[model samples]
Target: MTTGRHAGSRAPGSCAQSAPLVLALLLAGCAVGPDYHTPPLSGTEAPQGWHATLPHHGSRMALAHWWEQFHDPVLTQLVEQADATSPTIAQAVGRVREARASVSTNRAALLPQLKGSGSATRQGGFGGSQFAGGAGGLSAGALNPTLGLGTITTLGAQADASWEIDLFGGKRRSLEGADARLTASEADWHDARVSLAAEVANTYLQQRECEALVDIGAATLSSRQETLQLTERKFRAGFVAPADFAQAQATVGDAVNALEGQRAQCAQGIDKLVALTGLDHDALNGLLSKASAQIPAPPDPGVPDVPAQVLSQRPDVSSAERAVAGASADALASYRSKVRQAVQEVEDALVRLDASERRVDAATMADAQYAKVLEASNARYRLGAGSLLQLEDVRRTALQASQSLAAVKLERAQAWVALYKAVGGGWRDDAPNPHPDHKTTAPTAQGRTHTGSAS
Candidate 1:
């Protein structure tokens, strides 16, 4: 009897323990899809350090606010204006909002849904009428006994609830994909900002360089006019030939042509700036006038030696990586290719930046040497010891050297901008999440809250 009593008591305990085990098995079965895993980079894919020499020994700068490093308030203001008004940035923001909505929709799908309905109706009859409501009927006679007319009223209400049970983890996987896409959209927004800033800076630099060239052209024209005057005086005294005088006139004509061309180039640059800043020509001119006509020196953007570290900071790369995470097995290969391309871009930018630095140094020395030669030629020509042909040749050489210097400086500045963009303008994976007003925590089937991963 004691054994029987003990066995009976243990039956409920066994069922209680077995019940949880059964529920766990069911839950495990519902988790049908494979969990996402980050792909690891091979040694060849991720280098220990950069192959090209690091600029300024990889000295770091605040890459996120890279424009501020130039110390050009005009540039900063222009970048800010572009950021606010750029259609590209607006599109990106729209995409981020769309992704955020998708996440909310998918998250809501994982929870229960409830619906309620209510209805009321009234009927009149000449003789009598009856209305049904919840197994009871209202008789017309109860409403009006004196007349043969009567009215009946009916009212009904109902409530229903449903839960989808997640049967095969499809909803969860969908939510995961939505979350990744949202992250990618945010990264894309940052990428747009970085690209726009780099473009604006490069255009601004070009405009300044154009103004400098205009100045050079004006000075050259003045010098040629002086040479023409000198040649004319000598020709009248019969000390120089008519051919020399004609050649001097042709030189002045060429200078005038070149100066006009330079002015046109400067004007075109201003037009581009106006378009980029969304400002009218006059307003843009007013802003540009505040700053001197000189190329803003690009500050060294500290690049990390580790390829993976640098890639992580790039918004495009981050977006690509998220794509890989969210992509199906069939689409994974293509997304991985984008990541490889991003790495190649960084390496290419580094090589160009290194080469441009060397070019600038060489060009500077050549410009200085040519200037001295031109100065000596001018002095000799003024003293009537050098031929006009010799003086003109020296002048041309000096001008070419100066132009080369300017071109090389522009190349170096462009390289800096490219490198800045390559490294992601200092954007980080941990940047603040977009649409903070939206809830990140989703309710689970068991009434527990699951917080989404940070962007």
Candidate 2:
């Protein structure tokens, strides 16, 4: 009977040993949490071309190193400096590193965890009875020969391991979320770089425009001074009234005031450039001195293609799209909102560029007409058929038109800059789409296209 019982006990023990294997197999089939699927990109249904098409619709404009398109070495240098020194870019880089570290941390959860521990201890104790005689625990003076207390020493070490088995796929879901976040952070880093470059370019352009204004003010002042001198001579010789002389002097003063203001504006622009580039004032001055006084023409950026190209090139769009893919319902909705905003920004930039070009054309034509009028006035004044006031008025009108044209040219250039920034500053068309599963569409109809680069 005893032998039979022993054999039965052996079978029970064997079955108990196999229980863990069965449990593992069962857990393997169960995975918790909803599966992730890539979300469809929003606002990508527009046609290949922007609402406003460019003159060169067939050729593609490269936005990578878009600053180089301006052909300004100073602009190129400033962008490089901003990229290397900007704290914004550095912060973005740090975020990417942190996200990567988070991925590593969560990934560890997928594997079994093991820990080791060790300890050492010493203790001593004495029994009262041992120190006393055996006669009903007699007096301590009659101590037993065996009475003694000794310390015990022990050293021990152990290793323990455990695994969650991922019964409900919680760990898997967490890992997926981590991966998505990491991708988003990388996209953000790129976006930061794009934004930084655009800012530097814009600041550099502003400085150029300021210098151009200063030049105009200086020339106008010189012209006014010459006119004042001629008027003064006429007054001294009694050839012109005192009122006319006073008017000429006032005009010169106005010009001088305007020139001073323009110089102040130019200085402010330089200061801003210095701040953006993280360079010393003297160094920036050297770079500015090397650049031409005239505003450099904007590079001929080829026509923008389909909206999908925008999505691929724009880092913000890519990052937002990634967020939608891995985020919860609420967060996904927020990211979707950003997609539409991105599309709107591109459209707005194109419209502004188109409008600015028209203004430039109008200003140029007006300036030419005024020049002709000024010439006719000069001829009449020499023949004594026009009064001095009449000639001066025509000259002022011509000067005003020229100034308007200069300002318009600056605006056109700025419009082009806006377009570049809006279109992701030279993002490649073939850049990988965050949502690769969806097909991208293009615009069908073209209207007043935004063409030409800024100058």
Candidate 3:
């Protein structure tokens, strides 16, 4: 060893130890640039093929084609057409183009721009006096007089350009920000597709459900009308009291009114579906005639996966995650804004989870209460003490409870989708492009309950 300070200089490991420093300096010496350590990401593990709890997203999401999940041909056609021609999707495409243009504009500054410069001029004196200095004339002192328009225009083709050099990394950081924004815009486009698909699917579901309700109402009304006729005949034969006949008529009238209300709701749902597909009512009716347009209870939707992120292909979830990314990129562009908005978006997302939990709880409670009512009514009927009115009241209560439970479940599932999305879950499944190094699944809020109406 040469000395204490130089002792380690020649050591075998010393070179390796200094390699990191050398590399750091090499990176630093080129320019003081913005080193983008990815913003605090929500996910950690690469999303494992649509798990319930995956964190990082993949290159593409299945939910991007959400309508296909319903397996409706008409819906698929409408979605494809809407995707190609809808103003909303067109707007999103325009945004992508604009962001791409911005990136190009910013990147263009990274390289020297060459320009061919040329100028032409016709020099003339005031009042047509003798011209002295023109592009084709001699200098003022070399001319006979200096009173003419002295246009000493140089017509040389000169290429002039400049770049910031990115020495301080400012330009590079700006470029990074721009690049991120460009990608974010692309994500935004994908998000728009997802939103449209979801809107169509959800609305289709609504219309179908409305159709089912109308069917139920029609059946109930027809049944009550028959009962009323039976009661009137029995009263005419003096087999039942007049009060019973009147009651039957009243029940029939109620059923008729209910059916009319349901019909109106079904028509409104038809209008909503039409709006979603941008089709006229006649066109919608034509489409409806070709299909059942009936919505039954949806299947468990295959549960999507345990953590639910396994189905990271859900469009709503993907949209949420894209929003998170957009907010993240936006934050990078404006640091304080990112932090503030990140919290806000996260809060909003968490709230959805909270709302879902609450709805589930409420539905559970409602189911229990209605269960008690149904049990009581059954017991009274068994004892021959409960009137038909009492039995129907309890039956209606139980039915309403079931419907409420279903609605709550649907909303809860939707909230789960919203939470996963807000936290950037779906994107990590099939990212549709390269993603930052992080796993796919992430949660939005604390696992706890909060309240809201499911609808």
The lowest-lDDT stretch of 10 consecutive residues in candidate 2 is 446-455
Whole-model lDDT for model 1 versus the true structure?
A: 0.77
Give one digit per residue, the lDDT tens place, for model 1 in 61-141: 466667777788988888888877888877887888898899899999999999988766777777545544554333333
Q: In candidate 1, which residue pairs get closer than 3 Å at backbone N, Cα or C atoms, i.e. clash?
A: none
Instruction: State the weakest 10-residue window (summed lDDT) of model 3.
Output: 446-455
lDDT of 3 by residue, 219-252 (tens): 5566557656666776798866788778778877
Question: Residue 153 in candidate 1 has what lDDT?
Answer: 70
**lDDT on C-alpha atoms for all candidate structures:** 0.77, 0.68, 0.52
Q: What are the candidates' C-alpha RMSDs?
A: 5.4, 10.1, 12.5
**Candidate 2 lDDT, 345-406, residue by residue in tens:** 77777677777778988998998999899878767755547766886788788888988887
Q: Which residue ranges in model 2 land beyond 4 Å of their true spot?
A: 1-30, 42-49, 120-155, 372-385, 426-455
Give me the candidate number with maximum TM-score.
1
Give the count of colliding residue pairs in each prediction: 0, 11, 39
Instruction: Choose 1 or 2, whichever is better by TM-score.
Output: 1
